[model samples]
Target: MAAVETKALNGVKLKKKEHRNAYATMMYMGTPRDYEFYVATRVLIKSLVKLQVDADLVVIASLDVPLRWVRALEEEDGAKVVRVENINPYTGQQKRFKLTLNKLYAWSLVDYERVVMLDADNLFLQKTDVLFQCGQFCAVFINPCIFHTGLFVLQPSQEVFKDMIHSLETGKENPDGADQGFIGAYFPDLLDQPIFHPPLNGSNLDGQYRLPLGYQMDASYYYLRLRWRVPCGPNSVITFPGALWLKPWYWWSWPVLPLGIEWHETRRQTVGYAAEMPVVIIQSIIFLGIIVMTHVARPAISKLYYKNSDKTTSMMQTAIKFIEIWSILAAYVVPFAIIPRTIHPLVGWGLYFLGSIALSSVAINSFMLPAIQVFVPLIGIFGSLLVMAYPWYNNGVVRALAVFGYAFCYAPVAWGSVVKLLARLHVSVEREQFFPKLTESSPPSGVNKLC
Candidate 1:
């Protein structure tokens, strides 16, 4: 086990438990670049733990770990560190993906009946007492689950995990490559109304907008952020899911927190600054090129742009323009380099072959699904066995065997997709061939200009 990042948390929960069930996430890698996110989540979560909510809140991970190991603060007084030694990523194989699935496999052994899984950034304001009241799987999330990772609850029954793994294997033969497709497959009933921030009162600030912006999906992946443009007052107690997981060099000035919201800034100093660098000094600048307001830095900078009437709005507009440009540029790049051979076989035969097998796998299982008592754990066992098997393979001779199995399983429907990828990647481009079927009628007026 590794050290728990105050930011990431995971687990499933159900309603009606005397004490809340929980799990904290810890990543194995520790790089210096992770500092900003570190400081942000630390200040945020520490506040919640400090609240001393009732029940034994155990911070499970690395019993006694040292990061830079500042001797004076080497140990925290109240936080308890623990390491889980029995976890495995892949159950039945020696491969990495298998190891990954191995850990999620632990859900089968959880002690609690009702479990509420939340991300670490989810700071509970009022005791989430109502969470334990519901009977089915429910989530209390800030509206829009785009990039949100916290506040979802589930009643783990092993069957859900099993179906997810099966879906993962099915996707390997389809468009998606793994079980993530199956994550919420069995829990569709719980997907309708996740818990939220704004209570839809219809008259509140920003008038019923939710918090966090983690709901938008990008191609095959889920993006980060839960709410945007949400308005909030000062000193408000709300846990923060990651708002901008994209890189800073993206040029666009995306929202750090919501626009009108006064997010509490942590008091800690940022990572680095050099005294000799002029950009490092901000407190002294006034206006124009001068450090004092004589020509440079009033309010912030009035004299330099004093005569420009639209300066304030220009700054804001410029910021918005960069974001729009970045978004446009990002659209052109291949977000995912899908394997050249696709799964839909009309364009190619391999995918159809594989997809046929996948359909059969499901068809065989469907007969069981109609009978709940048998299908539930059967899905779990079925999925877990796949993870242990580590069936997916790479592109070598061994991988070729896996691919053959993959093609045999899904190619009937997916071969066309594979052919499209090959054509796009390897075929030569001719102007007419690339731009076929173009007939442009010259428009007479501005009204005829259609985008």
Candidate 2:
């Protein structure tokens, strides 16, 4: 135990001997969208190579990360990729942050004498090799005396990793619901350590294990200046501490902080900007065509039907009404087409379901249009009853209950549609953009009225 402690403590200093050290980061690409982390991690490695850092660069990534990305890290960037099984135990309100447990696994890489762990969102501005010499569990102060886990140095050991797992298994609560909170609790006095370093070539150790404040500059501080504080750089790395959405890869973020340009340039070189965006463009085009056809073609056809019909005037009017209603309902599917790639799965499915319902309703209305005005209310009531009661008769109680419960949920939508239909019945049609009103008295310009 004494020797273990001594070795662990000795690993922290910039001793005059060759030591196995690594600049490490953990990435969890659990979903397709998480591929952004792969891009960001690649940028970090690019920065390391560009600066000619001496230590080994290592990535501890989730097993789900694509093999090609792992290969790129190893072959292109010359970094070591350590794939690990992601065991997520946090299941509280902050379930999203549960993946931070993957980051804690870095302490289990017992091969490295000392490891400097960084978050994937960090951008290296200057060579941060000096962090390698820092003491065990050294980190920058987030608040007055609280350590920020975005960038930190520590001795890797099986014992620490086991203890972390044990703590979690034993129900040790982490207020932050992530690695930073667990770490802050584990090493409460981490702030007492020496500050990482002073500005290039400034001074020596002050016996404190803390790193210099500049090593992990609060990116939010760059924008808000909450305390009216300027960046105390020459910063070694800039850590994006808040929302991942604020990261530099997003083009819209350019106006707020041009730092994203640096990240974008790095990405363009490594992965290139030609990504899944083109698919979104194709989808946008398809939806645009649908919108144009709905506005132009459907109305024209409806107007023709209204003009040509002799004894079936009511039937023609119903067809025209169906076209107008169906076109407006179909427009719901268009908004999602703009950024199809980024939309949530549930939301995308919702729009799809809505358009399908609208199309089906149009089909039914076209067949029963002249009679629909009489049966609309009955159809809704009987439809609700059949949906709920059929499941109950078959002894599928859960399905029946779900059907019954969801019926009331649609009351608002049904009421709104009823109101809208009534209003449309009372008002005369116009030759406007969406609701084109073509009356016998006043038809479209240069076009005869449908008599």
Candidate 3:
């Protein structure tokens, strides 16, 4: 009987250890950013696993999140996925963040003693297992007064979860109507709490405490020193809380936010970009075919251009000019539309540049235009992207102002390019080379007959 009792006690202890803690993030569907966040979340989970943190990885995903994504999270990335219904306490909230309240489901995970809830934007630099030892609630105060919810520690409790749901139903006063605002209101006193310092003996603490800024180092801090210098606690994680478009997962965000490269490096080591490579390769092949065809068939294309001496010549010129302008616009827009939305930033930009060049070739070859004159729009676009992504701006307002300033300066240059192209088109029309010269023996073609 004594031996049996001891065995039973050991089994109970094992069960408790199995569910001691978890590092969790939430996912939902609706926005175009869904796939991007999925990729980011996978990287975050894999990074934690790479650190070999002493916790289970969990993803609190909404029902709308695709089944394949959930399976990948569980099988490929080694995370436990819990499907939940999306909570929308703030119906009037913007559609982008409408489902973010699903994060509240973290409190419902009573199987775990503690959970370190994270945003997918987090870049883990080191093991953060010590966060589990924090109290009932702990969060980094990245802002001077308000704690950021991007990375926070919480003890799972069904009672607390129920109370939160009730508060949401009761219409709690949430300034932003998203999880951050709601959670902030829920734990109003976190601002005044003492900073958490894990017990040396590995025992857990109980009440709310503030986590040091080191745990949630804002990426903007690196812009100042180009390195981290949070002297208080372990600089374990980095969070991007600024403009949504500048998130590290985006290819364009790198070099601008140099930290983005680090995120992609982690992704490369883990996920390996297998999903989007085929599409990229196929796109490259098609664009190459387009370039080759346009160049090889330039003579045939030139033959189709005909000189018009009648009054309709003005209308023909107007139509040709419209086509020229539209072609230029499409050259820029089509690449962005066709590329896979969730592709790695580097590949996405590469494909965009290639597509632009190939499409521009058609216009350049068809019109017999100067190559440099035709590519001015592409150069201007590249310049605009650089101006918008300049990272050293002190604030968003300054960034906006800088972009506006660039547009103000470049408007005249763009106009000059258009003017030059039109003048060249007029010269080509008069020369009769682009508009093929009609010999007296040649019969009128269908276009000429119609005119």
Candidate 4:
């Protein structure tokens, strides 16, 4: 009886130890990007589960993160939430990264034997279960001298957490006033550490080690070669540490960063786009209706523009030209407002193109403008997008110069299109034949009937 009881106790203890490691990410609120990052965090967690990683998925959310988002992370994404108070040790940080210091709470996860802290922008290419076997403090040196905190293995200790908090209170030497700089300052010697290689027998390591660049492959590297060729370690994860706007979740980043499609692909397979699909469907319907209605009612709309007097004709022409130009401008601006901010990039761009065509149709039909001439702005916008998205530019300087060259080449064509549009407007106004000639005998000389 005594031996059986001891065995049962040991079984319970072993079971408890099973969940001692977690793959962790942080979340905080009070930014316009809060929801974007929340969705990104969910995708990251779901991707980890999809990869069949052996460790628990954890979200170290701040107190202000919405309860609904927390529940979704817990129930839908299969992540364990650890709510921590937002740590604002640096009061002078930029608003964009103000809450990033909250990531320091990953060090307080004492229940986990090892935690692989991550940023929401990380895209895991495969299971990196071996990272759990690394030492108390292991990070990839994506830069030559700085170890990235985007993904790092850390052993949770109350003493360490307290020391870090105390250091914050006392003003640690943080250059950027964000978690990355503070943590980099905290572990300044990680660059000198030996590279971590998981033991074949799967035993855990004991001290800090430098993870190879393959683990935190920077997305910019792919822009140069259009592929990844990290020669060391397993190519486990990719991190987008560049401009905030180009983060993988944003739709505009798709063709600009081709790998963004991969992120959205994982999202589609896992959490899916149910949250934003309704908006996309409605927008599509509206655009299609505009295209059809404008085509069908072209004659009726054009008849309203004709006038008899020269002053009225000149004013009408000016008004029509202004409306056409503004309509073209609205075609470019309206789509950015209507498309769901976090919808898949392909869908967003599709809606944008469709919206541009649909809106441009109004101008095309009302003024009897040529379709090709009216769409010059749309064509120019597409050409500019292509120029900006070109992947082979040797550097940003070259990319900027290429864009300048394209704009320089395109300016004359744009001006010529405008000239053609003005000339076309003159002919249409003079002819007054955009619709069948008004049968009412021109409303008597010198008298104007404004429609």
Candidate 5:
């Protein structure tokens, strides 16, 4: 115990024993799949080292992490690995949450006097070791004014760990099914306190410290910083939270996201960079093809159908038809491609459906009734499916069978729609030819034909 204290004392003398600081993170895959945790951790440690952080680096990983990753963390990154058993705090109602409950183990890392616990997805832009001086439980505010758990300062204690476990076992439910909710419940008054840090708090330098807003920036903020001139220059760390798809490591995010560049920088240093522009180009081409098919191709085909109809095409009619087609394209493209950046995706979709219904009402009422609406749509559906399925056929016999099957389904529907449209046109022509004469013909009102 004396020897242990001596080592602890030496660590303290190096950076102030009571002020010993470390950056820690937690990882638990829960299920087997490709994840960005290892790569993100490597990048994070590298960033800290680059910034010359005067602190120990630690990662509390669940034992489920592969042996190779454990070695990478210890041997390659020079991080202390604290392996713990995975536990599921959520059982009955929220069993699937599996909300990295193992993170609570960070509180038990008593070796370090103060630790800045970070989410695996956090990337440091500059030195944040100054955060070690902050008081316990400092975190930046996210939505609804709650301090985000993504990056926070906390003092480690076995007592706090035992208390948290006690709360968990005693059915003290965490509404968010994660450490954030539980920690928030424990430190509800943290928001009310005046935090030190004159740049962040503007007044307090002697009291507690609140996390600066810039430190836990979401990657989306980078876009705002670019376009709208939002401040991002002073930020020390950036946190990638919300959804898995939003992470920078994914290949699809490379084109527009700034974090993609950061991720690539880390990869180039740690794992040697591979040229992914070809892959990105191919993906972009495929995505563009889908957009063209849905917007430009579908609308152009509908316009051709209208033009080929056996009716006198007037200038007004042509203009209306163009408007109708443009509306369809707008309905398909605007909400998905444009509006989601400004507002919620669900709201965008609502606007899309509403606009589509309003714009298509005239077209639907004019032809859909007599044109066999159900059959026309069925023909379109099967035709598209057949076209998509055509490239997959390898065998001649199977290809022939599929072609026959598609023809069998589509021919009748097409024929029915054409026949119905022609009959309706014929009826209209007959009515136009006779209606004027009937109106012009005078009947003898005085003479009773019945008599």
Candidate 6:
């Protein structure tokens, strides 16, 4: 181990040593993709390549689409692309890049000794040569430090793969979450590493970081430290990424990313319409509940919640805030809905699901629109009663629930529909722009995004 460490360290100081140590950054890509997606990653790649011609780096994008996007990635200027397929061993779900990035990194999918796993959705706003400090074993920021299950820097070796796989088997996970819980739980400190970088570099797209050095560790330590406070001034890299597996517009609220379109295509291939109807039923209930709660319930009670009539907008905003819980819930539910259910009538419920999304255009809630579409329904009855007890809720809110309740009487079936329709829409998410209509020939005006 000492000899191996010495050899790896010898190559780190120079950019292009004769025996150059590899330093890789990871991300996945797909075909018929948003040009903006690669465009954004290019910003980071350009910075890394500028640091050295022989930086020993490439963007690791996953391939789950039938539309070969490899050529498109090759066509991109100033990028070295490696395509990976995220084959979910347990579920056999191939379209799960978000859940599998860390697995890829831990598996040493790239050649470099140091691998930085970055989300393609993030922009490299500034230079970040600092990530090179953690030589081998592992290199990553630990703020809010769980594996994040998305992005990081790694000292790739067979050991990481073994440890990660081991953690999953031995580490106690939520069963519902993903590899994230296991990442920190098992590794606690480095799996068997000598020195891992401090999380002060930052973690997640939200730019959440904490404390200073000497005792600097990633958020994993902080999490382990049980909210331990340390010192860290600015100078950390700013990393903003998509918050969830799917983009928001794709009936999944994650982002309207191109992968969902690919998911839709593959579903068609495997079982055709036969397997998709259940998803439609589930989606319809989720959507109907969202529309009624944000549009109807919260707006009606916002003034009361805040005890300030002067701000109807405030009421709208509060309504939206309360509804955010539902959106978050619906997000949690839909991905699991990809499995087929046996709904009596998949067709009608599917239409109801579409109606909720289409009606999501109504801005009665606020400029953000469709606040309740996700918020109210996502919450179960336990919390709903608390919100209802507040006296501020009025008729509009009550009426909205009444209407939603009637429509979603058979919510299980309706929920499947919502998932099915969004799956069919060819939905795509890039940054914050979500165009509801997936197949529109013309792109949305002013919805263009920067990487």
- CA lDDT of each prediction against the hidden true structure: 0.31, 0.56, 0.73, 0.72, 0.54, 0.39
lDDT of 3 by residue, 1-451 (tens): 0011222212112123345799989898988688889999999999998998889888888777889998999888888887666678576777778888878878777777878899999978776676776668877775666777788888777678777877877778899989889988988877666556543222335533334565542211110111233222334677777888889887667545656667888889999788888999999999999999997887666556654452346667667767877887788889888887656777887789899999988887777667787788788878877886576776657777988898999899989988988898776555443345544334235422210
**Tens-place lDDT digits, model 2, residues 1-92:** 00112232222222122338888887775444476667778788888777888777888877777888888888988788776666566665
Tell me how far the alpha carbon of residue 271 in candidate 2 is from the true structure, in angstroms, after superposition.
2.6
Model 2 lDDT vs. the true structure? 0.56
Q: Candidate 3: where are CA atoms >4 Å away?
A: 1-19, 197-235, 313-316, 380-415, 425-451
- Over 231-345, each residue of candidate 5 has an lDDT whose tens digit, in order, gives 2234456676666655655543432233445655655665542333354345445445544444433322323222112344355444544554454445344434422221222
- Lowest-scoring 10 consecutive residues by lDDT in candidate 2? 220-229
Task: State model 1's lDDT.
Answer: 0.31
**Candidate 6, 189-282: lDDT as tens digits:** 6533433434443543454433444544433222211111211123334333355333311333211232223222322332235434566667
If both were scored by lDDT, which would come out higher, candidate 1 or candidate 5? 5
**How many residue pairs collide in each prediction?**
75, 17, 1, 0, 3, 58
Pairs of colliding residues, candidate 4: none
Q: What is the TM-score of each candidate against the true structure?
A: 0.35, 0.57, 0.76, 0.76, 0.51, 0.37
Residue by residue across 300-366, what tens digits does model 1's lDDT show? 2111111212223445444533443343223222111121221111211222223222332232221
Best-to-worst order by lDDT is 3, 4, 2, 5, 6, 1
In terms of TM-score, how similar is model 1 to the real structure? 0.35
For candidate 5, give the lDDT of residue 388: 34
How far off is residue 239 in model 6, in Å? 1.6
How much is the lDDT of residue 261 in candidate 3? 65
